[model samples]
Target: KISNEITQFTFPFDNDVWSIPVHRDNSYYESTYKKSPMSKTDTINTPATFETKDKLFVAIHEAALTDFASMTLLKAKGNQYKSDLVPWRDGVKVYAQTPFNTPWRTIIVGTKPGDLVTSTLMLNLNEPSKIEDTSWIEPSKYIGIWWGMHLETFTWGQGPKHGATTANTKRYIDFAAEHGLDGVLVEGWNVGWDGDWTADGSSFSFTKPYSDFDLDEITSYAKKKNVRLIGHHETAGAAKHYESQLEEAFKLYNSKGVNAVKTGYVNKYLDKKEWHDGQYGVRHYRKVVETAAKYKIMIDNHEPVKGTGLQRTYPNLMTQEGARGQEYNAWSNDGGNTPEYLNTILFTRMLAGPLDYTPGNFGFDYKLPQGAKVQTTLAAQLALYVVLFSPLQMASDLPENYVGKPEFKFIKEVPCIWADTKPLDSKIGGYNTIARKDWNSENWYLGAITNDEARD
Candidate 1:
């Protein structure tokens, strides 16, 4: 499994340990496992393939240069990287195409006030076998929304959406299709969400929906409207039952034309070691990949596992929310992420795969009408369509919120998967730039960001 084409970076210090800042606001976009494509701008050069370690190293260096340059320009204008102020930003986050544990690790160093530090990172995947040359699906043409309109049907914090009538669900689906959406997600559609957490965990029934929601009718109607009905499975609480019932679930979903599903492992339960299958977040995730492949159904996992280039092995494994996502709205007031963290994550958490960070909640900014639920600005959300990579991307914000906003074009233009990806710059938690091109089209998509204070 020795890849002569892999890059290697030797630090001057011992044990390859280094610290970098991770801004909390950047956490707004949780890393998902989806990807979109962009036309090649030819703005930067890329290596066709890393044929040797030297080439890989060269690629990283080149990417680092580009990232630094972009951030440097931004910093000159007075934008300071926020991650430098945080203590936890200095840690190793791996995103490899194969399962690779870097032989090296580092202790992060805090940046001086008003300063930006760039850290180099190594990219490797544990399973090179998973890498695929074929495009899983065209990037950008198709867009999706996650967890469906359930939150609209019922308030997230107000307990169950018992009042989520079938009429309400249809109305939401109709909106997506009317507005040219490709798919809609429906989380919390099972019995567990409504007080049957125990028995329902093992009793996974793809054919069934909560008493109030008519899944079959909804999916059928969605198809007629040319919109997809994305199914969901919350399994961390009931792994054993889910494993046993998986085939049936897939078969039922297949029968119903459910091409996509969002699986989740939310809570950390005791004595349920098998739920994670005695593997770290990444290893257990491989099992899901294998299972989904058999059924030919695409999957988007949340709160359960981390990704490391498995999309190449299983194209259907669309996206995963490995990092803090919009769900932060329900939890804390930390605001979740910042520009510094956004720039750093690309080099660390997303180096190996597509992120389903569920971008696009335009309603959160403090500047919006008083009492609005959104937390960030419309421009930032627009940036995510470029910054976050995913084949199964989500327009997580409510349809009503986007009603007359023309900025929605950014989402319309973002590609979900790419034919090839080139890391233009690599600075683990400082600044990073990625250039990905659609396999079919000459067009390319480029995303670059930096930690606090920018780089040069």
Candidate 2:
């Protein structure tokens, strides 16, 4: 049985209405047609949208970073007592018994589109931080050994050009120390990279380092340099296996004084037939976050569940690569990301949470193995540190790229955490200008970006 006329709600709209749909299902696995309200063309039940005398704006929130709920918005036509009329419906179904709460349905009410940019509704909706001891959790700018592997100049698996070897890692640690950076992320340092990780179910051992990479030596060296080592766990989407090894892996990192980790779920777990955004995936990610918190380890997720406002609840959930990040420019066959890409996400995807976009690319004109090139300028790259909100920002290029470069100053100086933010100017898929005040120093930083067009 369906309920009739749950409530008749109306708001004055001048130009268009933007409505964001909330869903708990894994968005990455679901088809666009199923996930989007606009796809429900024939039915009166469209995604949440507002229509005024002018234009109509429909906004859809894609993918669930967390689980089991469904939400929708329906528009009411004229006053006809017909059974066909569908009233606005926004609800959720959870199989779990009592004492559970549904995720917040965020509706930002504002006069203009930019007004939505400035709203604090999402942060306000989330519960206060569950982390009591935050002394260990600090925002940082990091340099990592991961990029060269992506560039294929170095390999994760052994043989030649192995990126995570002890000697190479020390170079990055030295670079971080020289640059006043706080952390160093070393990926592919473990034993299992030699195999087909996706198929080799339980082959990866997180605690054990590869023959060439000495965990003890590197951790001690980083301590001498006053730099923290950010650990990496590439599960290759084998969540169950990763979970089994989680305790031992985190224990290893903690013992080494490595307080942060970057986890990757690059592919789907074949046996489970599950997507990254599905219920099982959601729970798997949550378990990782909660478990990491238990060990005082901060998490930076790559190819992760879409970040809902969970960071507010779990402060250790520092940042995530939930969108098309900077790496696409290096090896993507699609000719890298466009100028408009960042602007598009700033309003849409970024509304959910912080993104580890991995900004700081100085080699703008450099061509990759795939012949893809970064389209943005050096200035625009500098602006990204301010534009994208992530506590764990990265100076992604190799240390050699920053030598004597003026733009590197911005990357070095930008604060990783902000106390206050003001969305100065914004338009969906067009341009964005944001100003954020540093949390510790109270200094202000501003980042502005234009789409494909050149702007003054």
Candidate 3:
């Protein structure tokens, strides 16, 4: 280890791929599908953490200037793996002035998985809430026009089958209102859905809705039903485009009483220059949270940087999608994620913060055209509402699939925010159960899930 920390360096090469050596740590977990929405290559492009075999995941979290990302990086250093902070990604250099205290290097430990599951080390490390008037930052359950696009039952692009049309959005709003859900999310209402938007989102528009969808009318109607219109801003990979329209977009939503938004960074950033969680990516995400705060908007960011307990500083940053989410069950390599997948991540990636795993899917028996299927049982689907922690949760299935099903009641009744969490029997990849006290009511909810084996 070096005695002096160098604030400036004289590397002759460009800042392409660089990381600062933080201290060294032993223990590496065997992870095949570390990144979520599991595909053949989500890892080569996604940020990863140090997963160890000791039934615990340890990481360094930034206390301030969170725009810098830290990692328990896994590199073949001689015979053992060491720790590092992925400071520079591709083009950006992490050069800061001196007198800067390094982020907190933390090691979260537990005898049983429960100890790791319920530990508040991440939240305890972060500063207190920056949003004083946090009444508007609601913990909600929403129904969205999302699964259809993934399921190939509907289209994100404008067409006869466009999922975000005015009619389709109204249908969801009505469903949410009738079911007592707090919000409705309608994606693909904007102008960027056509022709390779994810490859380069320079043409995406945040403020403008497609001609078939009515943002003002939809927002107004949702208000009448006492439901909020959860907004979406998918940048594909064009950060600058989204930044340019950030204020204009926030202004429109604010005027219409849209208090929450789900952002996407499904990017091919700057000819694949910046990483989604690099220093540049970190700064952009932080700006979104700060800017969203001014307009009293809560955010659920996807393809996001790992949560560093920043929600304490910006309560408006509600939750994040950084794990292999439910979508992997519908389409992934090896004919869908293994049954052990969910339990595995619950101990590892979930240690960071609240995750939007979008758990309540009733279509446990459906198969895609290519023969992939959801690996969870119906009971497990219900159990996820209690296990996964997301302030802005989603009942991630079509309304038709949910109606009249007896088990759907659990999704409706589950609480989004919790006052307390109690872990029960658990193994990292076998089975897990947890009970949580509701943030509002005195009601307590318990959720348990297992691997493919039937639990007695």
Candidate 4:
């Protein structure tokens, strides 16, 4: 039964409303028709004015009230689920995958009741309201380098030619300091590993050095060069125990001057109750945030909680790898970094919040051509710095690939975080164009990419 309890609003853009409607199933989209309130009388009364859509997590509007006449039919709100509306905006939007005792408020757009519009919707079960914070980690001045396990997996003591080796790692550190990168990230630094690829081997070292690679020396050396060392804690197959040791780990590492840590629980996909953890995969995540905040050390999550836009509450939650990332190079026979895949992410995964899916691969083709493998063209990689939003952005490619490449100038120009983010245009699974402004500068950065055919 369709309930008559209606939520109405006008549009909020200068152009026709280009909105992504949120449904009870947690799905969202870019509506084909402009959405707006309809009167019992269909008369062109006034000039085009703005409207707003106030929902828990989204708010947007349509300024040019052009094709909305056909989209007036809305699904009935019932005890089963509630509907949601969001208007497109050019700024950061917050989402929460699980409930917490933090303050999150909804953004109301448009001036009048009939002027509001909604773009996306979700199942709000004790759902916390979405609110904006005046304080956000501005990413304009910082550049980040991320070195993780998969690449480390390829090194195999064969030197830099294979992948990430000790010599290559040092070169990366030097390159960051020399080329003006503000921070460096090293994942897979935690203990427990088998020599030949045991999934969860017991023979690992947390405090000991790895085959002559000293953690203390790396941290100290990076510090001497004025570069920040980003730490990683890979609790392989151990989520419950990871939290118990948080304080001890933080104290020990912070004493060594490590300011940030990328904690991971990639075991979710593994078939085990211990691996599933609990509640939207955020029960343990909240604990980590609380503990990390107590220590005054920031965090970047990998294979952590799916961003329900919690960065608003816990600013230290930098970025996450919830989707298939660059590591697909090693596993997938044919890398699946397709244009459609990229397009699907914006409408799906990114709607939740910032992703640490590191972009920028200098080479492409590992097996067939035997060269460094990259997913897209260099320009597409460059555009990712603009399109894919994250607070701590990464230049994941090897230093040697970028040593003589002049195109890195563009990569260097991309801002990590922005004061405003505009979903300029989108075709859901086809293509999307986005524009972002530096948090401090007046300049704007735009990134646009297409799916297979490029029709959208």
Of the candidates shown, which would achieve the greatest TM-score relative to the real structure?
Answer: 3
Which residue pairs in candidate 2 have backbone atoms (N, alpha carbon, C) closer than 3 angstroms, thus clashing? 26-277, 26-278
Residue 148's lDDT within candidate 3 is 90
- For each of the candidates, the C-alpha root-mean-square deviation to the true structure, in angstroms, is 11.9, 5.8, 6.8, 11.3
Candidate 4, backbone clash total: 40
lDDT tens readout by residue for model 4, 139-200: 42233333333444343222333322344456567888887886676543444533432344
Worst lDDT run of 10 residues, candidate 3, spans: 18-27
Per-candidate TM-score against the hidden true structure: 0.65, 0.84, 0.86, 0.66
lDDT of 3 by residue, 217-256 (tens): 8888999999999999988867777898899899889999
> In model 3, where do residues sit more than 4 Å from their true spots?
1-65, 76-80, 87-93, 268-271
RMSD of 1: 11.9
Quote the lDDT for 296 in model 2: 95
lDDT of 1 by residue, 167-241 (tens): 665776787777777777766566555444533355445455667677778778878988777777876456566
Please report, as a residue range, the 10-residue window in candidate 1 with the lowest summed lDDT.
66-75
lDDT order of candidates, top first: 3, 2, 4, 1
Model 4 ranges off by over 4 Å: 1-168, 195-198, 201-207, 269-271, 275-277, 368-373, 454-456
